[model samples]
Target: MQRIGWTRPTAKTMRDMLHIGAPIFAELFLVSLFVMVDTALLKPCGTTAIAAVGLTAEPINVLEFLFFAVQTAVIARMARASAKNDRNAIHAIIRGYLKLTLASAALLAVLTGVFAVPFLTLFGGTADTLPIAVPYFQISLLAFVCRRMYGAMATILKGLDKPQWSFLLNLIANGINIVGDIVLINGYGPFPKLGALGAAVATVSGCAVGLVCAVVVMRDQLRAREIRIPLSDWLRSTWRETRAICTEALPMAGEKVMIRLGIFLSITRIAALGTTAFAAYRILISLQNFAYLGAEAVATTALIFLSKAYANHDRKAAQDAFSAAMVYGLAFSSLCAVLFFAVPGFLMSCYSDDPQVLSEGVRVLRIIFLYQPFQAVALIYASGMRSCRRAGIPSIITTVGIVLVRPSLVYLLAGPLGVCGAWIAIMTDEIVRCVLLFALRGKMWRQFTDAPTPSPAVV
Candidate 1:
């Protein structure tokens, strides 16, 4: 029988690569669109509404990355489990991680929900923005458990080479969110016009539905053995496994949180520039994310393939996976760059009609064109590094760039260059990050060259 990871690069390999990546891209695109929906829906309530959303988003982004660290850790380990064809190992990994995640999530929900106002205030909440932002943030925090669980399950599906299942489920969740946004934001059909609070309600409601659906879909897959959910030793000690995951996951979580903190601090500075600038920055980020998400999806697909191949002792397969990932990732991001450069106005119009917001958005977006290609490399290589557990240098480098370099440049340059300086600082950070990641590529793959392989048996 031909082994799955032994195939050399060919048209079929490329096709398979795309087949794995496209749904991931769609899922990422939909996630970004979910955020954009909030921004767009609230546009009618004025820029204050937009600013409140933006402020509230930073803290949420930080929290998401905290769980994202867990997801990344899960994907890496699960990929190896898949490669070994060991159902027991995969089950054990999931069970320990999910329990740890649930307990942590419960605590996080309590802390974040209880201190929602103080957290928002620290991020950039003004007296004006607080009244609207606090309730929205608190309500959203209440759904953190469901949202984090949904993400964990989706990561498992992806790690198991079942991206489509998770994508379809998320699409359903998004549909529910859209309906809630339309009716609740404007009080349509007896839904109260709660503005920002309504948006939060819609988001939480979507997550609740998503949690139920993901659990069901994942359960059905387990029954078919497309995924293996073992029923044994349910009360066994998982401390060792849980500790290993946490050790690997904590650095990643720290790196991301540090990066978010820098951005949160930067947001405070931008907010001081006035609401218009703050809102424009938010819109610009969403636009850039449309491009970033594609790279992210391609990176994720590569991570799964590379990790699996490494586990199977197939070095060539890992290399081929990275090559295919970069080719597709760069192509997608390059197209986004072209669109942003050629028709910035058209993209901006999707979110706002205000003349000032449009102008500032265009200026900042054009600046992003210089960084998009480098962004692709950074994301692709970073994924490979993290998958192989070579996260130490990558994490440190990311922290320095996002937390130290970018903000320092912004402080020094934003005075003379205005918002363009902020964008320029971002570009410079990506360029530095690309150079570092490229430099470390060899080290990233070297660790995997001698990795131990496990049995293909259930026990």
Candidate 2:
């Protein structure tokens, strides 16, 4: 039997992890900045506009899970293919998944646009917010395909070990978005002020640019000549790749759906707390996103490294990779925690100057700050399990937390404690999930190390 122990990562291990993680971190940071900038810009439009925009976040996320499901599978497959230097397999996976993602995104966008009013209403959009949210959501759908395509391409780039390229693409896209927000949201010169609608238009424009740039970069990066084959053969290869992708994607899709459902339910409860509370809740959530960005970047790096290690049956490498991810993720989250704890009021002030919003946001932000370390553990371990194709158990664990534990706690707590209670429920859920994931991951590590060789399928 092989032995596995908790070992500290070496210098080389840290460097390699940093090499992969830095770009991913930058990319995620830019994405978060996009949200923060939008929120700040929307301030002048009033809390209703801010709340209206926030109303669209979960619905849009639920819709985007279509892209996310496929993206996860693509990254897993592409990591394996890159490990083997199988250019043909990589090309097939990219083409098949990209086509499917674009079509699905387009279809979902149309349906979402058609049902925008009803969908926003279901998320607890009040009369004031509905008018603003519906049009904003419908307009945002125009960029749905482009945004999804950019995400798909970015994953492919990461799989190919070219994360910097993804970061560069996003930087350009979000720069455009931020500038557009200033000009369009407030109306400058020839452009009329569009308020929340302006933010939606800016998003559409940025996503479109990002998609085009991603295609160009992808083409340049994939310089391999196309394999000439009969149409039947081509179709067969594409179908096989798509089927494999879908098989991996289905479980992830369920996990994502459950998470969004939890958020959806949480939003309904918060929305009932009135616009001030809801808006404050939204701003704090946006601020809290900073805490996760580093952890997510490290998790993505761990996923790619774990995928390759599992594919090659390199258990030691996988162990070291996981260790590096946990360390890096925790360290980064600690920094964010300090910032959250130190100046909760200052951070809250960035989005709104309203005294009540600031007070309410500061209260919840501090609660969220305490759970950042646990949040990091949960994210890294979940990604680790997924990389080994053992996503089912982690998915189930997370689903229970998000679907059952979280909502139940919120339903019980939110009434008496207000927004603070809702966040406290979230914090509890994170700690519970973190502890469970840590134990499960240890068992998984032992199984991998004890096996004579990596199992051909998930153990």
Candidate 3:
């Protein structure tokens, strides 16, 4: 009867999330690494092949980001419900989002699979490159529908405030990918000889595994439900909320689309410089993905706490979580930033055996590092915004900063400044978000905290 905190996180909350977040981070990092491994193995196949895979990745990232936007909307709803202790709603949200995600995945997979060849060709793959691209793209399209299930499951786990399970699944999934990459890409022992296709197969296989695991998890939870809840019920009850979430998500999706486009442009700029630069850019992007895992984890941590606090109407707790995240996120980001700049060669050195790739990549590493502090600020605050369900404003900021400003400058500057110019563009975009969000979050948090019957830290 004396529940003080609207949603009280147990000792298990931080611990579990870290468990979940870390593996998710590591798995993605490993997946990125597998690409590097694929490229490394494929390097001997020739530069044209590497460029083909690299080029195909841009549209793939765009596609994936769109799905991510949907997941974000679903996660926002789940987090809100978790905060409110609406357990019944939680189950329905899970089933509802599952239906939405599966239908979308099925349609997109078919379309992408059907047109895979042309899409890659349009991206710059030549006849020789197209052979590799086609198989790889075909594999990607098939596996990705299953991948969306993993994505949705992971989000549901996180939304349920069980980040640990999400992380565990990723860890297991990454392990699967890394092993498959080693064996399939290089044809270890008895594995049949396959090239880029092998790598794609391996990657898809790993995601499929994740999908199965996700299904098992869901089944375990719904042991009591006789049927996966009907679509009609969801439309009647949650269609409005789903629409509201998607409305918020559209800007966020647009912003991420811009990022994918900008990065695609950056890759194009690098490719224009020729093979060495393109290979280097691929490695650099992979490394950047690894480096930003910390930023993402911290941001996610902030988002969870904010969601819980806001649901409970606990302004003090929300601020506490926000303040703690900035300090932690900044400190962690600064450390990685130092590593990126101070010894980038060491970082670049991990993935490739080529000297030219190392040399070209190391040059822009520092520029990317410059954005780390700002990246931390922006991501953490953005997470807070997502929690507050004011995702639209930050979404606008991100779209302007990432989609519009960054790519335009990078495209214009690339001819003169080379690869480094494109990275500088990336740094600038992040800083813009940092400045803009910092201006907004504090003022907004004040409103929630200034309300009556102050939220108790513990229930």
The regions of model 2 sitting more than 4 angstroms off are 1-3, 42-55, 124-136, 185-198, 224-237, 273-280, 352-366, 450-459
Give one digit per residue, the lDDT tens place, for model 2 in 1-459: 565555898879889889988999998888877776778899999999999998998788778776676677778778877876766677678768877787788888888888888878887789989988999899889877788888898899999989999999888888888889999999999999998899999989998899999988887787643423334543443666677788888888888888888887887888898899888987888778777778888888988988888777788888888888888998999999999999998999878999999998888878888999999988888887788777787789989998999999988998999999999999999999999997777656754555334323210
TM-scores for the candidates = 0.88, 0.87, 0.83
lDDT winner, 1 or 3 = 1
Quote the positional error of residue 174 for candidate 1 in Å. Answer: 2.0
Q: What TM-score does prediction 3 earn? A: 0.83
Cα lDDT tens digits for candidate 1, 138-245: 888766788888878888888888899878878988888888988888899867888778888988898899999988887876667665555665566777778878
| TM-score of candidate 2 to 2 decimals | 0.87
* TM-score top scorer: 1
lDDT of 1: 0.81
Give one clash count per candidate, in the order shown.
Answer: 0, 0, 4
Give stretches of model 3 more than 4 Å off. Answer: 1-21, 41-55, 178-194, 221-238, 273-281, 351-363, 411-416, 450-459
Report the C-alpha lDDT of model 3 over 397-454, residue by residue, as the tens digit. Answer: 8777866788788788777887777777778778888999987765456545543342
